[model samples]
Target chain A: MNFAQPVYYPKADYIETDTGNKVSRRATIAGPQNIILGGKTIISSTAIIRGDLRRTGPGHAVVISLGKYCLISEGCILRPPYKTYRGNFNYYPMKIGDHVHIGANTVVEAAMIGNYVEIGKNCIIGKFTMIKDCAKIADNTVIPPNTVVPALVLFSGSPGQFVENLPESTQELFESQTKQYYNRFQPLEG
Target chain B: MAPIKDRFTIHSKAVVCQDVDLRGEITIGSGTVVHPKATIFAITGPIVIGANCIIEEAVIIINRKKEVMRIGDENLFEIGCRVECPSIGDFNTISTRARVHYTLRLTSYCVIGAGCLVVLPEEEVLEEHTVIYGPASERRVWSGRGHIQELDLRRKHSEYLRETLPKFNRLRRGDGA
Candidate 1:
């Protein structure tokens, strides 16, 4: 199979959201097709979410997995590997959780992010940095490699620190924001 | 020292680069080296830097309105000096291990030693290598904060602030416009 042809949005059977918005896909990478969509997940145009572009083996292609109700903003880059053997490279099998809003131009190499997380724009979440659930990270904050963020906290800065706990007033805001994002891109049913 | 009346103008050949965001009305002089990974943000006022100065790595120069970060020529912010207040004077050599948090208006040919957290609001004179600190913490052994906490706070804070802040149209220099 020629892998040079750019992959297009699934044409035959894609559940459409009630908002009449099909997940827009433009200028994507080539690899093994491994996509997982649950509830309402909208992948925006000009967003690159896929696995590596190298040869894995027979019966194995690249694997790009998106969880249920994950909204990756425009210009976001998510690179997951197609096979487990190629997982030795740092940022393969990128895992994102439910009710997450990744801002524009944010580069996430995170293997996993807990639910209810809000990341700001121009931020770079480096490899192996696990941000726990209900954590709100401020914009331009760089989470360096091998950093562990505890749950329900607010992190900001170049190196990032636990400035304070998530205030009670902002908890509802965080929860509702995640729900709104997920609701906006819920996949349409057949 | 006393507060000045006007903004300091800089030459246009200032070297500002690498992961930096220069904001608000600020003037950077020619031959000034604002090194890689440095940030200069002026939200409420203007930032003025003089000619022939060197602002080293990871330095943060911020000024509130009515209190701008006014830096002088040939002075050096050597590696990680965070001057949040104005009143830093000319020919001052702020070492790598120093963090000046308060307003300090010094004359030319002075030195702020490394690992010093000098908070003197009044004018003072220091010989080269003289470490200064708060009067209450005088004679205390100076140690650095090791890691910066405000960078993350600033990153998180900039998110909320930028949403409502006035967007300054970066003048496209005819190359990418």
Candidate 2:
């Protein structure tokens, strides 16, 4: 196999490292390992990213792949391999695409998340849930497991029902706004 | 202290910090705070409380079999209120010692007076600041339309003054406005 030069730290943004001691910052990180924070993503105070690959099976290890310019707010739990109802199998790795905004107190244990997704406060996204790109989930929503959310759709309510689809221009605006959030993270705030 | 039965199954995401007594299939939403000594039982149907609600102390939220109870967010069920209503809207307030029974639904921002009886004699809407003093004499207003029992000497004088100008209505109307 011919050797190709590896691209080191591809994305430009802020990223905070949380190994054991907390290095909370609004930054992004890039890597193939577990808990790959997109270069320049802000992980707020007391935010725990349990990106241990050993929890999942070997080779297909677990990872919290947060995309570029994503803001995971305070007190949010983004567990990639979450426990299932059967009490045996855990869910797969969580894939959060670029420009996603996750509010406070949201517990998301899902397999995939699309780009420009905005999840409001106090929402509990069940395990193995697949959120389509540009979808909006309102506050206080409880999205059950195994849900296949469509693109540009609005999710609201207790069990969460499809409200309406967002326009393309609005989706673009939402996606572009998170870059400013990534830039605002000052390491001195610690 | 009573026996702790495994009736309610709270999700791991729910933040239930205080010690409260709950029975039957009660699903408390995320960020809901059930204060200490608040007892809730869904003996008949399920009691579903939405997120960000505060159930204060000594409040009992019970639902009989075949009847479901739903509560919206940011509601405060004050101390010692006995609520058996089927549904209550968001941002509502239930005052202390109020007896709510057979209530079909209470809309948002509605207020129940203290020591009052909020019930459906035959499914009626008791709008904001609705009050009822005596048992079985649940009148819409303090007029002689519904069962108005005679009061004692001091209470009769107070009743006369109440008929002229319901001061609580004036004060509570200020609250509603």
Candidate 3:
């Protein structure tokens, strides 16, 4: 009940998945049965994962699948894409590859994100977009739906478009940062 | 949704959703519909919302002043709008994703457009029917419908919301709903 001396973790701050992923206690993880988080992934507090928004009548249908060492920051929302097909609203799967980091308050409904992608804060990744590997999306960018972001490019703006090609070392940076974030994300102890 | 918090004074007719996070002294008037994930923090000062207000999903109203953050009747805060103002008058519509900073006095019939950030330190009052749109707080002349019309629309929406939302979340007069 006290604010001071807050450096204490009574239990674990996050629940460790069988694959070594960590999901914060404060994060809203709905219908976890539909979500597949790879090992070493970190989902921060206040993030919302709408795993319940999966395709209806599903067996082995993964609504949201995050690869290993991915980081989802605070207030981000990860929702599968929904579309009206054949007179009914159907949700599609969302897939993210390894070593990807989505920044704070970003909302991602993208169909696919390749490995080593880094999205900055306050981005709105439009539904059904295809983001290739080693891509970097800057803060406050809004990518239009169905837009394809080619590999190793930087995108930034209200409606996100290609800004420049990413450094060849972009993958290395993401790998290091993902591991660093995973290690730093721990329950406080007093 | 988090558990029903303590120290909240909600009217019997107020419809607060399941996931609202309240911390300090907060009060809501009758016929107000607060949707899921709406956060009302009154740690520094009390926040009193007037009647027939519709607070949509993820709307955050915080009071960070020495005085009470008084909100008047028929205010409609759309999805993801952040209100940290000292006082907001009647019939104000804060559109989606707009941020109203601390101590700004929003008068009646002001429409804050989507994604706008309003943080004018000098201007205390957003005069009658003024609209703030765009990320740079571009002040534009207000037009179209009157405040009465706006208030009626919001009230009707709130009425509809009360019936539909109660099906999902338990509603009570007290704080612990």
Per-residue lDDT of model 2, residues A1-190, tens digit only = 2143332221232344542112344321112355666655666653445453224344655367887778777666665543433333343567999888888867677789988899998676766889998999998676767888899899997567899988887576785566544444443432
Write the number of the candidate with greater lDDT, choosing between 2 and 3: 3
lDDT-based ranking, best first?
Answer: 3, 2, 1
Cα-based lDDT at residue A108, candidate 1: 68
Task: Report the C-alpha lDDT of model 3 over A71-167, residue by residue, as the tens digit.
Answer: 8998987877655556444668999999999999887889999999999998877679899999999999867678899999999986677788877
Computed on C-alpha atoms, the DockQ of candidate 1 is 0.02
DockQ per model, Cα: 0.02, 0.02, 0.07
* Model 1 alpha-carbon miss at residue A34, Å: 2.4
Candidate 2, lDDT over the whole model: 0.61
Q: Could you tell me which 10 consecutive residues in candidate 3 chain A have the lowest summed lDDT?
A: A1-10
The model with the greatest lDDT is: 3
TM-score of each: 0.41, 0.44, 0.63
Model 1, docking class = incorrect
Quote the positional error of residue A51 for candidate 1 in Å: 2.1
Model 2, A89: alpha-carbon shift in Å?
A: 3.2
Per prediction, the TM-score for chain B is 0.61, 0.64, 0.89
DockQ score for candidate 3: 0.07
Please give the ranking of all candidate structures by TM-score, highest first, separated by commas: 3, 2, 1
First chain TM-score for all predictions: 0.70, 0.75, 0.90
* Regions more than 4 Å wrong, model 1: A1-22, A27-29, A53-64, A81-91, A168-173, A182-190, B1-177
